[model samples]
Target: MHETEVVGLNVQRRRRGWPTLDIGPFFMFFGIAGTDHGREARMERRFEQEYFSNAVTLHLASALSPGTYALHGLPEEANKRGWTVGPQGGNPTGHLSADGLDELRGWMRRTPSQRDRRVRPERMLPPA
Candidate 1:
């Protein structure tokens, strides 16, 4: 199922026989503990630099709306709810610094537009 609930709110709705949102790979990262770093902070830093520093992370962070990740996706009733409550029913939050915004804008301009890209069904999970 594409639907997911967070804090009493249902985010994303997929109907049978209807067109579905074709978000690519749903990456779930698992970190190996107690690797080279002895301390937790050092390990976390290394992990972020190595794993989190990727095109997918950058695109998601830049492309999504401020609260897009709050409840995993945009809430079904987001228009009615306004900014007070997030999609997850928690405080709405997400921000980018001035430099970050500039960088994102540059990257977006350089990247080819994906509007015409053909989506392959085989790459996506079947709708439930």
Candidate 2:
């Protein structure tokens, strides 16, 4: 998986685990050092995943008090008609120190375009 700091990006290395191989199958990842307002301690378990043919991305962001989070992965359906997030959609696999599940479940931000939701007229489209 990919690791990127949304706020302060400190990229130590962004290359194959072993760069010597012309086409190495594995990538490298490093932990970030940051101050979090809060942290939920998941039970803790080994988490590792790798794909020989595709790339994955991850996002990490933290702020004071609380914020909303319902980032989407690729659309789950082959048709890509329905877009959703959280544990029910394009699920993220791994074990965390604390589930923070309730908090997570509470922040499934939805756009008006989602099913059953209507988009009100806006001033104008932001940009292309």
Tell me, by lDDT, which candidate is best: 1
Give the Cα lDDT of each candidate. 0.29, 0.24
| Model 2: residues with Cα > 4 Å off, grouped in runs | 1-91, 97-99, 109-128
How close is every model to the real structure, measured as TM-score? 0.20, 0.16
What is the per-residue lDDT of model 1 for residues 1-128, given as tens digits with 9 covering 90 to 100? 13222222112222123223322222223333333344466555554444322212221211222333322233222212122223434333323333433443443344456322111111122238
The C-alpha local distance difference test score for the whole of candidate 2 amounts to: 0.24
Which RMSD does model 1 reach against the true structure?
18.9
As a whole number from 0 to 100, the lDDT of residue 116 in candidate 2 is 28
Question: Backbone clashes per model, in order?
Answer: 0, 4
- Candidate 1 segments exceeding 4 Å error: 1-85, 88-93, 111-128
